[model samples]
Target chain A: DVKVTQSSRYLVKRTGEKVFLECVQDMDHENMFWYRQDPGLGLRLIYFSYDVKMKEKGDIPEGYSVSREKKERFSLILESASTNQTSMYLCASSLSYGNTIYFGEGSWLTVV
Target chain B: AQSVTQLDSHVSVSEGTPVLLRCNYSSSYSPSLFWYVQHPNKGLQLLLKYTSAATLVKGINGFEAEFKKSETSFHLTKPSAHMSDAAEYFCVVSTTGGGNKLTFGTGTQLKVEL
Candidate 1:
């Protein structure tokens, strides 16, 4: 079975604090993605990386950035967390385009 | 460009009753469709996918969805609702040109009653 592991299940951070949400996939997937999920609005992609050191902005990339220094690991960085940024962050990876994208358990971040 | 729309925000069904969750999509290129289920406080799980192979696609946990090109719809259904079936369902769409990017619907919350 493929497993996508998220480092943090939950976290509380003060406004203006930097936040890091880490994800690691056991499967050697070439594509990794970070998405923000909220009520009413569905999962909006924040960023995605098809290769190490290469990233692309998604529909809702504002207020967020991502790092993929290694192939199996991807990290979402919040430069300055804010109250509006409080939401569930999900990490996903796929073998390639048009394939099943497996997802992590998700990290719930609360900004106060 | 591709987009998905889930028709119902919420659907209530009693155990042993039929279940239906409607979805419609539009894509500039040939599209691939998927239905994902998210349980409470859990990650999204792929229930089924339609990649132009077959019109009727069967998925895990007795769930299935049919693809109708004439209607541009992919509706998920099950013969009987189970208590464990209560979850949020999302309809997603992607195209060959999208390059691994998926467009998601707002989602439908399914409530199963006794």
Candidate 2:
């Protein structure tokens, strides 16, 4: 079974704080993604990386950045957290550009 | 750009009854479709996928979906509904462009009544 793990399951941060959410996939998938889920909006993609050091913006990438320094690790960075940024963050990885995706349990971030 | 529309924002059904969730999509290419379920406070789980191989696709939890090109719809159905089946179901579509990026619907919340 493929397992994707996020560093934090629950986090709380204050406004204007820099927040980092880390994800690691055991399957060594080549494609990784970051998405923030909100009520009524569903899951909106934030950023995705097809390979190490390569990143692409998703539909809702504003105020968010991502890093893929290694194959197994992907990081989502919040430049400066805001109250509106509070939401459930999900990380997913796929073996290829278009394939079955395995998702991490998700990190719930709260910005105060 | 490709997009998906889940016709219902919420569907309520009794246990042991059939479950139906409607989804429609528009894509420039043949397109791949998927149904994902998310329990409260849990991650999304892929219930099934349609890769153009067959029009009728069977998925986990006794659920299935049919792809109708004429209607441009992929609706998810199940023979029986259980209490555990209550969750948010999302209809996803993948187009050929943009490196197979996926587009998700607004999502339908399924409520199973006793």
Candidate 3:
């Protein structure tokens, strides 16, 4: 079975603090994504990387950035966390277009 | 561009009763549709997907969905409701032009009672 591991299952940070959420996929998938999920908004993509060192902004990318220094690892960065940024962050990966995207267990981040 | 709509925000069913979740979609090109289930505090699980192969697609946990091009709908269904089936279900759509990016519906919360 494919495993998408998220480094943190829960985190609490003060406003203005820098936050990092890490994800690693064991399947060697080429496409990796970061999505923010909220109560009524479902899942909105924040950023995605199709290759190492390459990144693309998604629908909701204003408060987030991403890094893919290695093929299996994709990281989401919050330069300065805010109360509005408190939500569940999900990491997903897929082989390519038209393939099933597998998701991680998700990291719940709370900004106070 | 592609988009998805889940008609009902919530659906309730008694155990052993049938389950149905309605979904509609619009796209500029032929689309790939998927149904995903998210259990409480858990990750999203792919229940099924439609990729133009067959109109009817069967998935894990006795769940299935049918693709109707004429109606532009992909509705999920099951023969009987199980207490364990209670969760939030999302309808997602993607197109060739859209690459791997997907548009998701707001989601429908399923509630199963005795």
Candidate 4:
């Protein structure tokens, strides 16, 4: 079974704080992604990396960045957190471009 | 440009009743469609996928979907609804040449009644 593990299941941060959300996939998938899920808006892509050190901005990449340092690990960064950035962050990885993907349990971040 | 649309934001059904969640899509090329379910406070789970192989796709939890290229739709259905079926469902599309990118629908909240 493929497993995507998120480092933090819940987090609370004050406005203007830098937040980091880490994700590790045991499957060693090549493609990784960061998505922010909000009510009514659904899951919007934030960024995706096809390989280590390579990233592409997705539909909703503003105020967010991502890093893929290893084959099995991807990280999402919130440079400066704000109340609007409070939402559930999901990390996903796929075997290849457009192939079936797996999602982490999700990191719920709350900005005060 | 490719996009996915989930027709209803919310659908209510009773247990043992039929379930239908409609989704429509527009893509520049032959698309890969998927239906994902998310329980409250949980991550998204892939319910089923249409990869152009079969028009009718059966998925986990006794759910299924049918792809209609003519209408550009991939609608999810279940013969019976269970209380456990209550969740937020999303429709996603991956265009042939769109790389690994997936366009997601706004989402539909399925409420199963007793």
lDDT of 1 by residue, A4-103 (tens): 9998999999999999999999999999999999999999999999999999999988998899999999999999999999999999999988899899
**Candidate 4's C-alpha lDDT?**
0.92
Q: After TM-score superposition, what is the CA distance of residue B39 in candidate 4 from its true location, in Å?
A: 0.4
List clashing residue pairs in candidate 2: none
Those runs of model 3 whose alpha carbons end farther than 4 Å from true positions after fitting are none
> Model 1's lDDT to the true fold?
0.95
Q: What is the lDDT of candidate 2?
A: 0.93
Each candidate: what lDDT?
A: 0.95, 0.93, 0.95, 0.92
For candidate 2, lDDT tens digit of each residue in B1-85?
Answer: 7999999999999999999999999998889899999998889999999988989999999999999999999999999999999
Looking at model 4, residue B41 earns an lDDT score of: 88
User: Which candidate, 2 or 4, has the higher lDDT?
Assistant: 2
Poorly placed runs, candidate 1 (over 4 Å): none
Query: Which CAPRI tier for candidate 1?
Result: high
lDDT of 2 at B92: 93
lDDT per residue for candidate 3 within B1-114, as digits (tens), equals 888999999999999999999999999998999999999889999999999999999999999999999999999999999999999999999898886688899999999999
How do the residues A19-104 of candidate 4 rate in per-residue lDDT, one tens digit apiece?
99999999878899999998899889999999999999999899988888898999999999999999999999888855787898
lDDT of 2 at B36: 94
What share of the reference contacts survives in each candidate? 0.67, 0.51, 0.69, 0.59
DockQ of 1: 0.82
lDDT by residue (tens digit), candidate 3, A1-112: 9899999999999999999999999999999999999998899999999999999999999988899999999999999999999999999999988889899999999999
All candidates: interface RMSD: 0.7, 1.2, 0.7, 1.2
